[model samples]
Each structure stands twice: as structure tokens, then as C-alpha cells.
Target chain A: MHTLALIFPYAVAFTVPLLAASLGGLFSERSGVVNIGLEGLMVSGSFTCAVVASRMETVLGPGNPGALWMGLGAAVVVGALFSLLHAFASISLKANQVISGTAINMIAGSLTVFLARTMTGSGNVRIVLGFIPSDIPVLSGIPILGPLFFTKTYATTWLMAAVLAVAWFVIYKTPFGLRLRACGEHPQTADAAGINVYRMRYIAVVLSGALAGLAGGIILVTYSGEFNGNVAGLGFLALAALIFGQWKPLGILGATAFFGFAATIANVSQVIPQFSRIPGLLLKAFPYVVTLIALVLFSKSSQAPRASGEPFDQGKR
Target chain B: MSRFKNLFTALAAVVLGLLAGAVFMALSGSNPLAGFYYLFRGGLMNMERIGNTLASATTLVFTGLAVAFSFKTGLFNIGASGQMLMGGLTATAIGLSVQMPRMILLPLIVLAAAAAGALWAAIPGFLKAKFNVHEVVATIMMNWIAYWTVYYTIPAYFKGTFLETESRRIPALASFRVEWLTNIFRGSYINMGVFLALTAVIVIAIILEKTTLGFELKAVGFNRYAAEYAGIHVPKNIVLSMSISGILAGLAGATYYLGYAVNMQIGVVPSAGIDGIAVALLGANSPWGVLASSLFFGILHSGKGFMNAMTKVPPEIGDTIIAIIIYFAATGVLFTRLWERITRKWNKEA
Candidate 1:
């Protein structure tokens, strides 16, 4: 129980960013677009958030939360704008989605660093402050669950949870969500039904970009506290989580949590004496190896959107 | 006419990329003309600099061939970085451990690297062939697996005396840098890898153009179902194409770690693998085209540092230019449409 409490906060910290990004992926893939540029999107967001927050800190003074909020807002906006490139190439220009996504990654990676070098000679931006963790007043009074879920938690965790809930409701319950899924499953049928397939996919892809940007912002304010031009491949991990979760909202949550826990255990094993018996290498490589096995297991029953990677052509039968 | 069109498209993409880079430079308050002046001059000003550019091109040539070869069979081999790492690791292990004559040892190292890379890539090929999995995702998974594997293997068995991040340097005897070649290039890192890359270019060209296997592979790439119906073994060819691609990438790793760099470093997924995609696209996925495109990229890469030192432009501008070119290449269809519209306008005017 003691150790569980000790690691729970860290686990949640890891899970929130992944959950946010995976949910973003869910929106894009469900809209009939395969977005392999999630990693690049996250990098752009992180870079935007870092630059905005660091600049705001000098004016607002250190420890002000307002700067972080402003940074998060900027990240979301930039992320949405950046994704338009992918949308244009894949949607309008009819380019290969995977290749376009790869180009997106390369552009984000190089351009951000290039700009950073011009702004700050070092090409790295570190903020003066991040969100401080505090126990929830009312929730902390609970017995077992409080310590695991509420105590010593960053406010961003609850914010992400709320976002997850809203995503679930919007995707599963709304008429718009049905149109989006229909576009992915059978765009021709959806077009005949007057669903405006292109518009739905555009909206979905943009929303995903915004959410992924928010995920990057959350990483900046919560745990990462810096932007180093790359997100350590967390975006790719989120893509894996989306696949592992079978593209459902709740499934994404479960899969991200699993990866988050595994990552936390690997990270903290060196500090804890009980975990010292396991080889550090094994612990470090555990999640990736498990993801591979999961891929093999799930490949046969994949729930991927049928028309996800295909460009819609009205002239085709 | 189609070949000429491909050449024109590639040239246009390069022009667009450079213009985008200039826009970035102007935004950064640097003189784009001056930056480019220094950039080209840096790559060609002296014998040593030219040698460095060629040395850089050697690695790009092999990786470019790797990507182009796989594209011939309709597979996107994004795992070239992982394959390169495995190959480099194999060569590094042998270089560090073995005591042998240079003639015999170099061949052994090259062969070992090739085999290691081939095995690494074959797993993804197998998965794609057997499980009906998408090669893109599978290759990505393989890349991370290889990353973690290297992250583990390097520090555990091959750690340097002072730094845990890198391995011990290869001895001169095991290195691809020979005395006469070093003297000819005025003590630059130019090595026998250039010859190996040239030889690979010729060999791959022959395999792709002159052999029945090449015909089968291209047929499979054109249309898998049609090729299968025509009695070609699509699955076998897919694996074979990937394996051959892996062999090229592995040889690239050998050239890089054994020839250019002295030691292996952990935690970096080589950018050369991703850059190979750009090379292949620019080269039109042809062997000779790959060689030409790689040399251009080589100049951009090797000149970047010198350009940074000489001007206000940041070194990352070179990488940004490469990336923009890739984005433009991915949208090559847009250019084709624009070209048709312009041609129609010209005809109307005439």
C-alpha cells in the first residue's frame, strides 16, 4: 500500500500525456485518416509551450500559473495550424498519408530546433516553474483510493481526465461522432447519405491536432518542465496505446495506464530495494517488448478503420 | 518523357526547399544569399572538405540504395536506422575483439554487418508476409525494439573506459581509413567505404536491371495480386527485397562506424535512415539516381557546420531544407497538376 501510493502519482503523471495523445489519435484514425505524425505534433506542441511559458515567466515573474495557462493555449493553436499541412497534403493534394506524416515529423523536428537556435543560442528552453502537486481537500479524506488518486496530484491530471470523459461522450453519444465514424467505415455511403465526408474528416483531424497539442502542453506544465525539440517518442508510444486499446475511448485509457505503470516501475526500480533483483535492462525494455507481443496478438482482430489510409476519390466506383 | 518529368519534379522540389530555407533565414534576420554562398563554398573550398563531403555521401549512398531497393518491392522499410545500428554493432564488436590481418578482417566485418542487418529487417518482412500486418507499423515497432536492444547491449558489454554513452574506439588496423587514401585526401576521413559504396551501386543496378529476380520484384511492386496470378511468389520476393535492402543499410552502418566515426554511441536513432527516404524520392528510386541525389545531400550535410560558423544562419537550416524538400516530394502530385495547368495555358497562348 505504501509503495503503491509512492508510485501512483508518478504513474498518473506518465499516463495523462499518453492518454491525451492516444485520444487525439482516436479522433484522427476514426475520421479515416492515418496520422503517423503524432510524434511530430507532440514535438511542435512541446516546443510552442516551452517557448511561450519561458517568455511569459520573465514578465510575470517566476511561479505564476498564468504563464503556463497562456503557454498551453498557444500550444493548442500552433498544433492545430501545424496539422493543416498534413490535412492539405493527405486530404486535398492526395499524397501518401504515411509519407506526408513522415514529412510532418521531419519538418516539425528541424524547423522547431532551427527557430529555437535563432531565439535561444542553446536550442533548449527550460521553464522556471511547473505545476506543484497538492492533495485534493475533500477527496483526501477517503480511505484507500484517496492516496492513490487524489493525494499529491497535479491539477493537469484531473483536467486530462475531464477531457477524456468529454471525448468519450462526444465520440460515443453524439450524432457528429456517427457521421465521423461513417466517413471512416464507408465514405461513399456517408457521402450518399449527405454526411459531408471531407468536412467531418477535416474537423476530426483538426480536433486531434488541438488535443495532441494540449497533451504536449500538459507534459510541459506537469512533469517535463522543458522543451528539448523532441518528446522522447511519447507520441509514438501513444499511437501504440491507441492500437493496443483497440481504438475505443475506455480501451485507450486502460492501455495507456498499463504502459504508464510499466514505465513508472522501470524508472523507479533503481531507487527501490525490492525491485533491485530484476535486471535494469529487462525492466527498461519491458513495455516495448510487451507492445510487440500485444501487436502480434491483436493483429488478427484489429479494429482499425477500414478506409483509414485511403484517399477518397469520387470518380472511383 | 516520363523520366524527364521525374527529373523536372525533383529539381522543382529542390528549388522549393531552398526557397523555404531562405524564407526561414530571412525570418531569422540572416542574409540568405550570403548564407548560401558560404554553404556551397564550405563544401568545395578545399581538398579535405571535398573528401569529407564524399565520405558523408558514402553513407547516404548505401542508405539511399537500401530505401530504393525496398521501394522496388512495394515495402516501406522505415527500420533502416535499426538495421544500421545492428550492423554497426556487429562490426564494432568484431573490430574491438578480433586480432587478424586487415585483408581478411575487413571482409569478415562487412559480411557480419550485412548478415546482422538482414536478420533484423527480415523479422518485419516475415510479420508483414505472414500476419497481414502493415509494414509501416511493424517496422516502427522493430525500430524501437532495436533502440532498446542497443541501449541495453552497449552499456553492459561495450562501455568505454571514461564514458558510458559510447564504446571503445576502433583501432587503426581495423579502421577503413588506409594510409595511401588518407594521404591522397590530405588527412581527411575519406576511406575505402567510397569504393564499397560505388561497388554496391553497380551491383544493385545489375541486380535490379539485369536479373529475373529484379523483374519479379518490380512486377510484384506494380501490382501484387496481378503478379501473384502470373505465378510470382509475392511473399518470398517481399522478404528477399527487404533482406537485400537491409544488406545495403548494414553496409552503410559499417561505413559510418568503422570508416567515418571511430566508436558507437547510444540513444541516437540515426537521422541518415530517415534522410534516405528523401534521397530515394529525389533519386526516383533508381541506383544511379540515388548516387546523384546522395552527393547533393552530402554537400548540404557536410557544409552545414561550416556555414553556421561563417554566417548568422543556424546549422539546423540545412536539416530544415532537407525536411522541406521531403514535404514537397511527398506532395509531388501537386506539382504535376500545376505543371499540366501551366502547359495548358502555354498551349492556349500559342
Candidate 2:
């Protein structure tokens, strides 16, 4: 029970970001733009959220709940706007998607670090917000389930779950979903069938940017409660989780849970007797190792979208 | 006409990037002219700074070569970071462990580092060649593995003290330093590593331009189907190209550790692997081109601190500049095509 207790918070926290990013990835990939810049978007979003939330605390006397929402809104807007760079490079310019994506990653990384340093008057800042966990009246009394599912988990976790459910429905059950998938499978074919491949891809990539940004925001306001250069790499780990989940929303949820569990173990390993002596870095490396193994095993069987990383060319097609 | 168009396109990208940077500076309330002045002066003014630039450029040279080698074979070797880390660690181990003469020890340490990098990169190369797995994701995952493994192993097996995470310094005999270069620069860390990097560029140029193996690799890169039909072993060439690329990346780490730092300390050495990508990309993934690009990047990096010292601008402005430069460089060719099309359309109308 105690072990479960130790693992659950991390599991919930990890899922929020992973699910959001994976859904974002799905949308973008479905619309035929492979978004390797998801990590950069997340970092930008995290920085925006942290800075906004901290500034709000300063302005609103530290106890305003609306500060968090404002930060979330700021993150989404920043994320969406940044995605425009990728859209312009990939969709409009018809550049190599990987290179453009990598450029975005570099730009985001430098810009975020620069902004954070400038904003905080130092290299680091603690983001303060007024969202403490308040128990639901009747639901709070349920012994194990309440704590595991509801009581201690941040509102973002529930939000992620809702987002995932909506994503699943929108992606798999709707007409727009069919068009998006068709665009990924064969953009020329989709175009011939009267679909706007460019517009769809642009929308998908933008949505991905927004979700990645939201994930970044959640990490800042909920889990770490601070923003630093460390969080920049989490988006990459989320990318790993996206692949490990085999690019499915449900699969990604499970993969994130596993990684989250590994993260929790690494975090609390010092408390555990036998694992304490092992270097914490090695334990921390577990999820990456698992991801590598999973990729090695499944890559042969995995079927990526036909137009995964290729920029669409109307004339060439 | 095509040459003129290409030059114009490249100039336009440079102009656009500068404009964007100027806007950013203005938004941040900094004087753009003062910032550019600091950047230009810091990078080019004095002898000590030039030596510092050369030292950093030497490291970038190896990384650039590594990236270019794989790119010529039509592979994006994103695992260069992991390979470089492994190379550095292995070279440090050799440098610390060996008691041989300088002539033997220096080459041996470098060779071992190259091998370590090659072995590390081979995992992804093999996966991509054998299983048709995308190298990008695999290489990225490999990077995380290498980083953590190196981080963990460094403290566990090579800890020199109870408190410090760094290993013991390399023995003096195994180190590579140029006395003349050091004298000229008045005791800067500039060494024979720059010559070695130049030699590598020459060797890569020869191999890429003059060899049958290079032809095979290029054929595979140009079109795998055509290469296979031409009786070239596609998978073998892919693996070999990646291995060679990895070896160069590793050699970069080795040179930095054995010739420059003389000690392997976690988080102290900048990520030569990631920086190598920028160097390679900016060089247009050409061997000679990479050499020139690396020198430019090295100058910017080495002068960043000097710029901060001389002016009120932060060192991160250098990173911003580098990022913008790389972004423009990556899309420079595309911009050229767009420019050509626009010019042709105007010419037709006229």
C-alpha cells in the first residue's frame, strides 16, 4: 500500500504530460506533419506558464486561483504561435521536416533559457500558485481509490483524462479524423478526394504545439513547482513514450505510466534499502533503457504513416 | 546565373536572420549596434581570443566531420552526442591508464576513443540497416542511454575523491600539446589536435572524392534501390558509413579530453555532439565546408564570454545568434530555389 502510495503521485503527474503530448503527436502525424519540435513547444509552454504564474502571484497577492488559468492560456497561445514556424518551414517552404523540427528545438531551447534567466533576475525561479488539493466531499472518504484517483492528484490529471477521451473520439470516430488519417496515409490521394491536406496538416501541427505547451505548463504548475533547464529534456522523454506507446493514445497512457513508475522508483530509491546503494543516475536511466528495448523489439513490426516526415509538394505529387 | 542566385539566397537568409535578431534585441531593450559590436570585436580582435577560438574550433571540426560523414551516406546520425560521450570517456580511461611513450600512447588513446564511439553508434546503425528502423528515433534514444550510462559510470568507477564526481587527470605522457602553438598564444590550451582535425578533413575529402568505398556510400545515399541494383551492398555500406561517422565523433571527444581538458568531469564539458550537428549543418554537410563552418562557430563560442566581459550583453546572445545562423543555413538551399523560381517568373513576364 505504501509502495503504491509512493508510485501513484508520479504516475498521475507523468500521465498528464505524456497523454497530452502523445495526443498532440497523433493529431500532427495524422495530418501528415511529423512534429519532432514537440519538445521545444513544451519547453516554451513551461517557461511561459512558470513566468506568468509567478508574475500573477506577485500581482494578485498570492492566493488567486485564476492565476493558474491565465498561465495555462498564455502557454497555449505561445505554443500555437511557435508551431507556426514549423508549419511555415514544412508546409509552406517544403523543407525537410526533421531539419526544420531540429531547428525549432534549438531555437526554443535557447530562447526559453534566455527568457527564464532574464525574467527571474537569476538563473532559476520558483513558480507560486494557489491550487492546493481540496478533496471532493463524499469522494474523499473512499479509502484507497480516493487517494489514488482523486484526492491528491492535481486538476491537470483529470483534465488530461478528459482531453484523452475527447481526442480518442475525435481522432477515431469523426469524419475529420478520417480525412486527417487519409492525409497521412497518402496526401495526394486525399487531395484528389477533395481534402485540403495543407490546411489539415497546419491545424494538426498547431494543435500539437498547443497540447505540448499545455503539458509543459502542467509540469511547471503541478509537478516541479519550478522552471529550469532540466524540464527541456522531458519533452524528448515524452517523444520516447510516444514511440513506445506505438503512437496510440491508450498505448501511450500505459507507456507513460510505466515510465512514471520508473521515475518514481528512481526518486524514492534512497528510501528503499536494497536499491539505495545503486547509483541514482542508472536507476533514472531505466525508462530510456526500457524505451530502447521496446523500440528494438517493435520497430520491425511498427508501421509509421506513409508520409510521416516528408513535406508535401503539390507539383511533385 | 544559378551561382548568383545561390549567393543572393544565402545573403537574404543572413539578412532575415539578422533582422529577426535585431527585433528580439529591441524587444528585450538592448542596443543592437552595441550587441553586434561586442560580438564582432570579441570574436576577432586579439591573439588570445583567436587561440581560444581555434581550440574550440578543433573540437567542432571532429564533430562536423562525424556528422558530414554520415550525411554523405544519406543518414542522419543524431547519436553523435552519445558516440562523442563514449569516445571521451574511453579516451580519458586510456589517457589515465596508459604509461606508454607519447608517440604510441597518443595514437592508441585516439584509436580507442574512435572504436568506443563506433561501437556505441553501431547499435542504431545495425538496427536501421537490419530492421528498417528509423535512425532518428533510435539515435535519440541511444543518446539518453549513453548520457546516463556515462554519468553513472563516471562517479561509480572513476571517482577520484569521496566528494568530487570527476575522475583523476590523464598522465602527462599521453597528452598532446604543441609547444610552438602554446608559445605563440602565451600559454593558451591550443594543441596538435587542430592539425589532427585538419588531417581528418583532408583524409575525408580524399576518401569521399577519390575512393571506391566512398562511391559505394554515395550510391547508396543517392538511391538504395539503384545502389543494390549496381551490386553495392546497401546494408553493409549503411553500417560502415555510420561506424565511420561514429569513429570521427569519438575522436572528437578523445581530443578534447586527452589534449584539452586532461580530465573527465561530468557537466563541465559542453555537449560536443549537439554542437557538432550545428557545425555540420552550417557547413552544408561538406568536409571542407564543415572545416570553415566549425572555425566560425568556434570563434563565436570562444568569444561569447569575452563579449559578456566587454559589454553588458549576456553570453546567451551568442547562442541565439548561433541558433539563428543554423536555422537559416539549414533552409538556405530551399530559399535559393524559391528565389530562382521568383526570378524566372519575373523574367518570363518581362
Categorize the docking of model 1: medium
Model 2 lDDT per residue over A1-317, tens place: 76776577767776678678777887887778888888888888888888888889888757366788788889988999998888888888777777777778778877777666666556465776535655666786789987777667677777888998988888889999889888888999999999998998999899999999898888887877777754636677777777788767788888888877887788788987767998787787778777878887887778567788788877777
Error of 1 at B241 (Å): 2.0
Q: What stretches of model 1 exceed 4 Å from their correct place?
A: B342-350
Look at candidate 2 and tell me the lDDT of residue B274: 69
**Candidate 2 positional error at B162, Å:** 8.1
True contacts kept of each: 0.72, 0.49
Q: Alpha carbon lDDT of residue B120, candidate 1?
A: 84
Interface RMSD of each: 1.2, 1.9
> Can you write out model 2's per-residue Cα lDDT over B1-350, one digit (the tens) per residue?
86566456545655666676666666666787776777767766777677778888989999889888898888988788888888988987777766888888888988899999998888888988887777877888778777777777777777765446787776677776667787887666677888889999999999898999999998998899999999999999999999999999898888887777767777543466767877787666778878887887787778777766775566676677667766776677677878878898999999
TM-score of chain B of each: 0.96, 0.91
- TM-score, model 1 to reference: 0.97
Compared with the true structure, all predictions reach lDDT values of 0.89, 0.79
